[model samples]
Target: MTLAKSSELGITHLPDHTELPESDGTFVKNFQEHPQSLLLTDSITDVLQQLHPDHQFAIGQDCGIYWRLTEPPEKGAEAPDWFYVPNVPPMLNGKFRRSYVLWQEYVAPLIVLEFVSGDGSEERDKTPLTGKFWVYEQAIRVPFYGIYEFSKASVEVYHLVDGKYQLLPANERGHYSIPPMGVELGIWQGQYKNMTAPWLRWWDTQGNLLLSSDEKSQQLTSQLEEVSSQLEQEQEKAERLAEKLRQMGIDPDQL
Candidate 1:
């Protein structure tokens, strides 16, 4: 997807600054406790680094959110599993965050992700929880919503069309394109963190797969080990040739 398909994107209109609450360290602590969200969170963090290395965006990692509602502070809806504001700094002046303040971030997240793991009921975690999606797409007007079934290895992406969230079908490669994020959310049938599932993956706007940090590290390590083994073989061959020449009554080095 390209920007040509978009109307006036309101990204530039919003103020680029964000505000933090006064020393509420509880939210960050709670967010880090959820280990299941790590896969999605780490993948997203890697993508952010590649797309905007200089922290040229505002991102949330399963942290606090400020919903667009006038509800009581305790009753207001929460932040998403993961979200990003492309036009804001990745960090607040080279620092990490624990919560997001809506009053400061006037703009909506360009894309939001929900890893489908709500209830501690069963292996599938089939607890009823989708009200958040409506709140985000309909109430908050987030441009895109990405839902991933971590257990089933599936993804369904939706886009806001005429103020309605319309589900976008998978492409030829089972990837759903998100026009707002400049990337496609897809399930890659591969191994990640030693588990094999349809992993939530990031692809460029052109549909090319973006390599996660772990993946890139694995690739580079494999290449270096290959080179090392080849060097060892060469050294072995050279030693054998030198020994043969000595046996044939000539010091190869002197010759």
Candidate 2:
């Protein structure tokens, strides 16, 4: 479908050039109350943070988006699995957060990704308040919406264009990219944290898989060590050659 006019859509895309939360405690509490639901919910937070590193994301977090309903939901809401209000800070309070508290930030996440907890991901990956065909298009108004099924290793990505959510075309690798985030999202078939099966992983600007913070650090360290060792070996070889030349009564320094 043809994209809507800029005036009609009212979306101002931010340039990419311009651009951690401890959920263990809350998980335990919410787990006792609703174990299965909490897992999916917590997973959303992790994924959202990874997917959209440029924006502040929160799970069970109320958004400051314009709610056409008579009034916004509760101030401190335990709402959806994950939601992002763009143009917000990247830090989180040490303790629990009551809803997203959008007023304080005056922004919301541009994208939100939710995971299916149970009962067929098709069912769990729905937002009735939002239209069926275009849920994020109508209700959440997030630029991009991603729904994932942990068990099935299924995923769907949607982008906001012409004031509507447009399904992103996947490549051979079953991947999609977001202009705002300057990254791509795809199903990675492998193990993560001991879990087998495909899991979501981040990619760098060059499309290289972005290793976890620890992995990246270790890789750089190893590279440095390798270079250092090579340099040492080269120096030793040069010294030996020069010593041999000197022993032969040759002016090694001149040579």
Candidate 3:
């Protein structure tokens, strides 16, 4: 799986998403990863929609981001567990992207999050070319990188500053603020999809937890029920007043 040879063709050439290998044949490291990715994507979907009214945004869950050309095409790509790239259409050329080819898109993701499955060494590695941290900060130049560890119930975010990554300090709510997105990233201990544990989640800058589609639906249903109950109570009170007027020999309907 080699890239097209520019020299043999006598013209500079770069492969697009369609030509890239979407996977490296590696198994998912843990069971928690899939759900964690979904939770993050689900919770932030509304925010992304609001941010990109034109619907020009992409959210990749365990999808490869091709950064370079290598012998095995997959080697050049790093598939963050979860990532968000703004201003790019969710699909490419009327087709969903098989993978994000940086050479073609030329848009780095706004944020790349890696869920730490092992000792967290790979996520934090700084070795040139091969390390995740180096690939993100030095090559891809992603503005924000998050390393989340569910076992530790913790997350550490780094903001690319002056060609280096700076550890962002958590605010009063113990959440890292991504000002550009108008949201904060943090860990919340709760049940999502019936799995109870510390899950990485998002919040607004005002420290409000961003609800997922399911959570929002539940909230709306509860509010509607409460409103219906109050309306019924008011109707009963009106009937009771009419009865009192009738007992006093007053024409309640005419009044």
Candidate 4:
């Protein structure tokens, strides 16, 4: 089924940004208790910012996404663990975004990521018109939807094809490439934020893993230390050669 635009769907009245409700109090109860979820979300946002230093984008974690065609703007909304809407200002009216209103922005999220918490049922729910899966697939029509299982270190990506969410095949490196964002999503087993576990991470188009701020610092420090050590080795070798020449009755400094 081809998805209908807001105009075709009889959503003639678009609410202004000020008319939309920022918070519906749905994300108040331990919304993001999992530490990995927070880490992964922050890591993705950081890497994206570093990659596109000039691009403007809005990223939200546990932030309500207000999307409705005919009903009130805030009637039903989904708060994905992480969502990205490119080309939109990160803030609205010089203020940090409290939520994303589709009609007001006139752009749906390009990518939405959900980190599986309790049972994987909700993340995979496909009930028509009411389920989160249906809302993203049919209502909001997000381009890419990703479900990540932290415990199993698995990632499932779905691309919107013909108005339906279709599972995408992974590349050789077991990552799903997001063409619009020029990045790939995959699981990496490593230490982040002092916690060692399998974490979801982003990679560049060339499959280079995006490093967090701390990781980048560590890599640069390592490179500098290696250069310093190599210089010391070269200096010692030159001194030894000069000493041998001097012992053979040649003034190495004058030569």
Compared with the true structure, all predictions reach lDDT values of 0.62, 0.52, 0.91, 0.78
Cα lDDT, model 1, residue 129: 29
Q: Give the alpha carbon lDDT tens digit for every residue of 127-153 in model 2.
A: 545333344565545677776666677
Lowest summed-lDDT stretch of 10 residues in model 4?
Answer: 25-34
lDDT, candidate 3, equals 0.91
Highest-TM-score candidate: 3
lDDT of 1 by residue, 1-255 (tens): 001111233233322223323232343334222443565555566666677778677767566565532212323345566777876766665667556555555567888777666441321222222256656755567788777776677777778889877889888777887664566778777766666666677787787777666877888999999999999999999999999999999898997
The order by descending lDDT is 3, 4, 1, 2
lDDT of 3 by residue, 103-127 (tens): 7888899999999988899999999
Worst 10 residues of 2 by lDDT: 14-23
Q: List the residue pairs that clash in candidate 3.
A: none
> TM-score of model 4 relative to the true fold?
0.84
- TM-score of each candidate? 0.68, 0.59, 0.91, 0.84
Off by over 4 Å in 3: 1-12
Residue pairs that clash (backbone atoms under 3 angstroms), model 1? 55-90, 57-88, 57-89
Clash count list over all predictions: 3, 6, 0, 0
lDDT of 4 by residue, 158-217 (tens): 999999999999999999999887889998888787678778888988999977767778
